[model samples]
Target: MMLDRSITNTLWQLQDANSRQVLALVQKFELPEIVARILVTRGINVENASDFLYPLIKSLLPDPFSLLDMDKAVDRIILAITNNEKIAIFGDYDVDGATSAALIHRYLKEIGINSTIYIPDRIDEGYGLNTAALLKLKKQEVGLCISVDCGTIAYQPIDDAKSFGLDIIVVDHHISMESLPNAVAVINPNRFDENFPYNNLAAVGVSFLLIVAFNKILREKGFFISKKEPNLFDLLDLVALGTVCDVMQITGLNRALVSQGLKVMSARKNVGLRILFDNLRILEKPSVAHLGFSIGPCINAGGRVGEASLGARLLSTCNEEEAYQIALKLINFNNARKVLENEALSEALLQVEQSVTLNTKFIMVSGNWHQGIIGIIASRLKEQSHLPTIVISLNNGIGKASCRSVPGIDIGAAVLSAKFMDLIIEGGGHSMAAGFSIKDHKIRDLHDFFAERFADFVKEKMIKVDGIITVKSVNLSLWNQLRRLEPFGVGHPEPRFIIQGVRIINPEIIGTNHIKCLITDGNTTARAIAFRSVNTKLSSAIMQSGVKTILGRISVNYWNGREFVQFVIEDLMT
Candidate 1:
């Protein structure tokens, strides 16, 4: 039977789980009923439940050489290290790219090699390898250039680097075409010719594998016989930061990487990361949420509004003073980015309110927006409207756009298709996100193309509930039991449960948009918060004085020295 829609204009569906399987999970693993149900719904059976709940790197880490051209890339990097060649790392301008570059650079530095880290300007250089940047590196006498987090599709630039007497190795994780770029080595799991078991790694994850292979070969060749080898484990903090920030699926190897990486982050081993944490006033133990929301955005702020290379420099630096200065600068840049983001988001929301209609299938808004901030604007709009959104920033007659897509939609493929049809000047991305350039005159055509492409897509938003519970059941014990499913992201999501027959008490606005209130079942009350719900129907329903059912994830909120269970509201039933 179909359930009625919630106040958010979407149906709330309870996830289905087999009763027999749930019982087996509970009996075999000694798990709680709700946790077992969650595991069952995620297709976790007795055979794989152990591995899923307790993912270890030793068990999940694949042979680094399993990726195609891994040996070739390792050999080239070893040659560069042995011959004392000047190496330059060209990376993208996001958190993933910065961490990839920093990871490789730190590994190289530990091996007594100093390499230049180059992050292309988002506005000036756009993304990936450019001919001018390669020529500039060549002029600086850089013999080997490793392009991290990008360069999978830079056919012309890689070829140009070859002609210019600079050998380039591409360490990336973006989807590849049937034909490959002419780099010295193209090490990517997603290569069509490759048979890598796990291909959904972020670019930083790919870079880590490259270093692993490189380290293995060096050890076999007795290169580290006298000198101490770099401890690769120390680098997991960067891996975790990149993996979470890139929004990679936290399963299998990624789950292990982040699980271990959080431990490393807590130790404050990385000087830059430690200073960043201190400057940001993050006193609590680090979690995936802290990495993705707090640290990642600050690192990304440099690429968006300030110097593109600041994040890489901060991550790679060892000098305490340098790290401190860079951390402060990134924080300031992030603050500035927030101001710009708020302004752009406000403008975009106004456009949506004025122009968007119920028939609108795709939302595309263009303005004199900051080029670096459009991606964030698109993300905010997508969350609000539940539609694939494209936010474009206009400069002269050219338009630079960033796209964010909903589930079941392939925005990247759509952008690529648009590019193939000459609707865009240049574009490519993964399924959920993409970017492209187009002429201002073709804006209407691009909109029409996306509209037609997504015409059959359902516009209604849905929230899947794990199970139903009462307000009395919201407690620390339940939250701790749910902690077994930690490090949630794309594949493994934080569980959302429905709390029935709740009434709001002491509802007040907190922060800018969040509502802080106490939800009660007339007997027991629990603290609840609805984040970014202001001005929405959800907020309206949350403030009303009536019996209501709410869906939210349970979490622990610490204030001062007291810890209390907090319900994070997602949707409300009225």
Candidate 2:
């Protein structure tokens, strides 16, 4: 029983002309042919296939005046909101910088244009354009500054806010660094010339298409109201919870911006996102995995454990009892960011189980960890050891990092190889995520510069297995036709199914360290479980196997209650 079903060259397969054009458009939209072969192996081709097989609110969105410098970023923020000046907006405290800085500070105060936002405090000024808070918004003479979900890597605070004159713009979506940050207008769709046809938006859907191109340039300059187009779909539930808590990739116009931003977050209509969806009791209909593991970790737990301007003042508060006391102080700062992300992910998993010869293939641990929660413990060890990590946080000597990658590893090119070996005074991010700054003995030169950059970027790269399905296509009508592919974040995922043979019946050891088997051999009967599979000796050697055997599984279950499946027995033979 030396199980290792092999699959993991950073898992990613499926492209036989995008899986037979996603099984002939899920048999021409009759769907459920295993959710049309996982939505044509997640490319959703065939002319955008009925918008991911039917994610309506009218498809083919785009026209926030067709993107490219979004009409010069909405004609220079409506000429700094009709010259009364002082605008601001900044943002970035997670959940797509607190819903794109609370939807451009409530659409510049619903056109009366007062706007003032800011945000930046991921543990007091981290993540994005700082210059001592742009020199206190250029000593509050601000004038213009837009940003939202971060300025495409500021480039020295947009060159010190244009040498303290101001008029920046930015509205980002991340990937883009060839040198484009003297910001005067940069609404990114990962801008590289911005064809704007769509390349995965969600910095609150590019700041709600720069507030629908600044309300169509304040409706052809009639200035504010003639009363008509201002319903930016009621701020698309804060741009679908910051595009599914900044993971984006739900697909094209971010799946119509998180399916109409989860129906304007289930009609709770602002009031501090309905008191943060009533303190996460979640008064129903929010999904995209509850806007990424529950309201994007309670709005990134006030920028990782309190006061990153309390999730941009509970997403620009107005009332409802001061958004229920900042939604109970952002749910007690997300229970203190889950006890500071599980005490630095249980001491970085006990220093990755007592440093097994510094497990190479890219990993750069550090100690005293908490650079505002070591990027959620390098995203739970790049989702449990898929690889490319980086979780620093020294003290007296500085350090401070936070990475997390796996899919074909590129944690911002392994922290830009410690900023090309200058010992990283600041690195960047992209492929899978990044962030840096260093010098506490630059941890073995950032663990030998990510082991010579994952010996040519993540070993040889191959094990991604997006295939293997059957087991009567895990029914419930293929989970309600994979719920019409309703909102599956970061490049549309959900659809795995692996099941091969079956035979467990009476396994046991339920919760408090799970097991719960129940599969049957007679053609296939289900009910499997694994979650920490009862302290592993391969769960009592597959419950003391006597005869029957053959296994592999992946279509997991338990939507909100949490009984995951996608059969993770990985591999076993008897």
Candidate 3:
């Protein structure tokens, strides 16, 4: 159900000549002129068009040693490996942290170091490193503790680990604070003064650097017995999953990670991945869509609704039976998550409609929402209302909130304001997404804080569209044209098209509440379906309009082996 869309509606007209210009520049280097224009409009030009369009291995990859702490991080890890010292990995329960933990653990084991893996339980303990877990590692007399995906934010936790007489090496990719933590090596690209080539690497990418450095150290120590230092590109499969699931921008290194990662995933080396593909009925050749919607969610489900360790174990294990068991458990958890997400989203939407006069650019919803699924719910609400949203789950006297943002709104900035004024107990994230905690009674203060800050920022902002297109461009060729922009996300989003004045025929229902129709914009005909818009004004227009229909920012789709375009229906003018 893809469409003939442009990156910007006004930048370039959808035509074959422009597409051929784009095609001649890249591997898909021979697409329609409209595609070339869309690609160009999405910030791809003649010089870098080939790179963006193809995402080649050489072009996307950066030098492994480009990071500042690469040598230090590698030397220390290699020393630990040589001494046969016991190493424990401390990781968060989220997908990024879990996957990074698993990736590092797998690489270590492959190099014959059976490191002890420790993932903090979300239900029992909170996000970052807990003192109790460190004490347990102390009891085990572990020599080194490698912190993955987290710990950059934990000023006290790192200090505590050191006080407990433990050696710590932090390998994370989260935004950092001004003061650094006390550790043997802190390998984070976001560290202040870091001129690292790419700040967009996920935690897994950071872990990959440690692996690269360790290999370098090993080779320097006369242990060089590798074919091109063991292609780390293969690990992109894990990298892609974590990057996408964690909701990082798809530009620079992050884009390369997913682009190459998708290729490895389609090959399906990991047994647990094989089961996931088999059960989900995903084809051998997976796509960005498959990774984003299919694989990422199932892995995230374990952390959100079940055990975060489940995803890590699944990715790390070689035991087929264990992998299968974990996959089944994750799938079941994902199923349960869907129902919970539906209920929470529905309630949030209803509340938005009821409060039509809320004078704020951001919406904050607090209730007894499930803490694990709050982030996804926040994302849904953000999309549903086109406003920054924070969904908090209150338990006892404490509340945990997950935030999702919209264009022109900095949710992170909003959360930071609440934190600064002592409204929220703790808060952290980027401009677009964030997480926070507040005392039960402080919810109102936090809301007012966010509302005020958002209002101030709103005056200087506007809706930032990714790219635009139209319905007439829908064709078999455009499907492949969209493929040129593989691994679409945060920064490089999928192409969105605006199709208006299209006639609808025999509007039959599909999905739980969807529609199947023939959408004809006179010269071009595309099979269009609308999801969850069955009874909305969009559906009503298709039903009642005597002439034609208007469409806006619609996503291309394919269902039951048939291609089509679908509209989100921004508005209708008849």
Candidate 4:
């Protein structure tokens, strides 16, 4: 039976079946009904629930050879490893790119291969493989160049590298074109001609597969008989960080990778990561939230506003002092990025509010905003309006735009179409997000094109609530039980529940813009906080209501070494 409820006037959607099988799961698995309902909603059954709760990397891992061109890619790398060729790693300047490059570089270093890392400047060189950089690598005597988190669509640059007598290998997971690059090998599950099962894997995830295949071949060759083998488990920390930072769905192999990676992170083998955790005062074992919000932001700060290579360097460094210095630098960079992001976001919001084309289904804003901060601002605008948002920052006679889309919308495809039609200079991205560049004169055309594309798109706003329960039933044990479904991200979102018939008392403002209140059922009182809800409709409604239905998550909160359960309110229906 589906429990119907509404919060903030948005319909509550439960993305799973409501049937007797939920009770059957509760009885068979000895689970709380709420937990069983969540599992049932996700289609977790008796056969896979055990594996789902305790996913093992070894079991979840697919054969490396399952990906297309895996053999050729491994053969080329093995040749480089044996011949001692100078290899160069060309990576994008984001967290996924940095971690992907670092994962390969670190793996190579372990197997006695030294490789140089190159990241293109976001502003000057733009994204993906560049001819100038490839030529520079060729002149430097680098025999092979490998592109990570990029190069799936870089046709001309790979051709240029081949002409320069430099062989290229592409290990990426981006959306690929029909014709593969002219590189030595292109190992991407998303390639048009390929049908790899794990297309959702992040770039770092793909890089990890290369390392696995390389290690297997080397072990078969008895290379490790003469020397101690590098423990690949230690590298899970990097894989976990990259996977979460890229915002991939935490399911299947990704869940196993991040689950084990979190354990590796707790070991603190990566000096740079440890230093970052320490400086950030993260005393507890890091969670998915810490990785996404705290550590990932710091690592990405370098690529966003500082040196593009700094992030990879920080992640790859082994020196403790150097790690500390880089960590501090990243902290400062993150601070600077926050300031720029705030300014750009404010401007973008104003532009959207005052736009003449405000009647369009998608929000489009263009201004003299900071180029680096437009992506984050576009995401914020999308959340605020529940519509696709495009934020363009004009520089000189050209404009660069970043787009974020809601569900049931394909902003990236629209941008790609615009690019193909000559309405934009260049753009390609996945369904949820994308970026592109256009001439200043084409801004109006781009807006009109997107408006037309989204004209038939119906906007929706819904909150998903997993279950309805009494606040008194929440406890630390229950929180710990729910955590079995750990490393939650895009696909496996953290569960939210509804606690109905709670009286709101002593509503007060807390740090920044959060609302703190005491929610009571007249038997037990539980604390609840609505983050960033100040001066909003949610806050105004909460202030005026005496008794309300609280829609949120139940979590065990540790305050001053005391542990207790509290309601983490998401929304309220009065």
C-alpha local distance difference test of each model: 0.90, 0.69, 0.73, 0.85
* Best of the candidates, lDDT: 1
The 10 consecutive residues of candidate 1 with the worst lDDT sum are 1-10
User: What C-alpha lDDT does candidate 3 achieve relative to the native structure?
Assistant: 0.73
Clashing residue pairs for model 4: none
Single out the weakest 10-residue window by summed lDDT for candidate 4.
1-10
Model 2 whole-model lDDT (C-alpha atoms)? 0.69
Which runs in model 1 stand beyond 4 Å of their true positions? none
For model 4, residues 1-574, the per-residue Cα lDDT tens digits are 3344444546676556567877777777788777888888887987788778788988889999989999998999889877878999999888889999999999888877899999998888888889999999999999998899988778888898999899999998877656788989999888888878888888999999999998999999999999889999899999999999887889999999999999999999998899999899887777898999899989888878887888899889889999999999999999999999878877777777787353569898888876777878887888777889888889899998888888899776788688779898777777777888899998988878887888888765777778777878666777887886787888898898878888888889987689988888889887777877887778897788577777888766556657677788877777
Q: What is the alpha-carbon lDDT of model 4 when measured against the actual structure?
A: 0.85
Displacement of the residue 571 alpha carbon in candidate 1, Å: 0.6
lDDT of 4 at 563: 69
Q: What does candidate 2's lDDT look like per residue over 1-574, in tens digits?
A: 1223332322333334355776777567666555565555556666778766566654567677777678887777767766778888888777777778888888778766777777776555777878888778878888787877667767887887788787688888766666688888887776667777665666777787777767766777776456545677888888777767656567766777678778777887778877777677776566777768776787778777677767777777787787788778878878776776767777788887676443357666788866778888887776656677888888888877878787776676556556766877876766777787788876786687677767765443323234555545544555555666767667666544434455677777765667777665567666666665564445766687454333443444655765443354543444
Q: What local lDDT score does residue 25 receive in model 2, on the 0 to 100 scale?
A: 75
Q: Can you tell me which runs of candidate 3 are displaced by over 4 Å? A: 1-31, 226-229, 356-358, 459-473, 521-525, 552-573
**How many clashing pairs per prediction, in order?**
0, 10, 17, 0
TM-score per candidate, chains pooled? 0.97, 0.34, 0.88, 0.95
